[model samples]
Target: MAIPLSWWLTVAAALFAIGLYGVLSRRNAIGVLLGIELMLNAANINLVAFWRFITPQALTGQVFAIFVIGIAAAEAAAGLAIIISAYRRRRTVVVDELDTMRW
Candidate 1:
């Protein structure tokens, strides 16, 4: 027996909510990036679950999930690079501490 779609959706929703809370509450740059990644994975879970339950024959959802994975990888790389550069210049990775442009 397969798992229900509602179960998948509930898991994804919970993951997304946790990620959102992390993104909003974390002050560290890396923590925020991790939260963003969590959100992306939650989206992927939802996409695959919908595709499995709603259109198992079609490959669209799998393809979209793959694309999202690629995008998330790229995003993580770029975000890390930015965070590293900011830390190098400022000696800190706290989001609020890197605000050099604040006038």
Candidate 2:
């Protein structure tokens, strides 16, 4: 019994929706980061799923997914570093409270 492409797409779409909601509803910096991560993962799933169903012989999908993972890791690291620095100075991780740069 092989899994269907539609199923994969459905799952990815659901994940993307959840991630979008998380990004919009959360008031914390870490929550936004997590939402971004979820969205990235959903994109990777779609890329690999399409590649597998459309061109199994090509390595493009897998390669792109790997590249996306690397980029996500780098983004996470940098975002965390900035969040930590902000927390150290502001003492709050709340998005609303961290808006010191807003003129």
Candidate 3:
């Protein structure tokens, strides 16, 4: 038997929620970046699942999801580079430690 669309959507929503929670609670910059990556993947899953269930005949949703994945990869790379640079300069990756440059 095939899976229901509602179930897929629900799972996607849960993934998004978990990612959001991680982003909100994590103190390490890398952890926050991981959360953002998770959030992006959750969105990608939702898009692909919706395409599979709601519009199987069309390719738009899949195409958009692919674009999102590409963009997400770029974002992750850039974010990691920045995080590395920040850690190099600050000697710590904790969010609380980032406040010194807030001025």
Candidate 4:
């Protein structure tokens, strides 16, 4: 029995929505990053699902997915480094509280 594309799409949509909510509602920097990761994962799922259903012969979709994963990893590393530096300077990881960026 094969699964349908709609099912995969629906799941991705839900995951993306939840991630968006997390990003918008969270005050902590780490929480926002986690939301971003979830969104990225949702994107990955969509890409793979589409590739599997639309063109299983082509590897482009998987290549793109891998690229996205690489980018996400770099983003996470840089984001964490910045967050850690900010926390060391300000002692808080709350986004609204970090106002040092404002001129």
| Candidate 2, pairs of clashing residues | none
For candidate 4, lDDT tens digit of each residue in 4-79?
9999999999999999999999999999999999999999999999899998999989999999999999999999
List, residue by residue over 17-47, the lDDT tens digit for candidate 2.
Answer: 9999999999999999999999999999999
Q: Which ten residues in a row have the lowest lDDT in candidate 4?
A: 1-10
Q: Which number leads on TM-score?
A: 1
What is each predicted model's overall lDDT from 0 to 1? 0.95, 0.96, 0.91, 0.96
What is the Cα-based lDDT of residue 27 in candidate 2?
95
Off by over 4 Å in 3: 101-103
Worst 10 residues of 1 by lDDT: 1-10
Clashing pairs in 1: none
**Against the true structure, what is each candidate's TM-score?**
0.96, 0.95, 0.93, 0.95
Shift of residue 21 alpha carbon in model 2, Å: 0.7
Prediction 4 global C-alpha lDDT? 0.96
Task: Kindly report which residue stretches of model 2 are placed more than 4 angstroms away from their true locations once superposed.
Answer: none
Native-referenced Cα lDDT, model 3: 0.91
Better of 2 and 3 by TM-score: 2
Candidate number with the higher TM-score (1 or 4) = 1
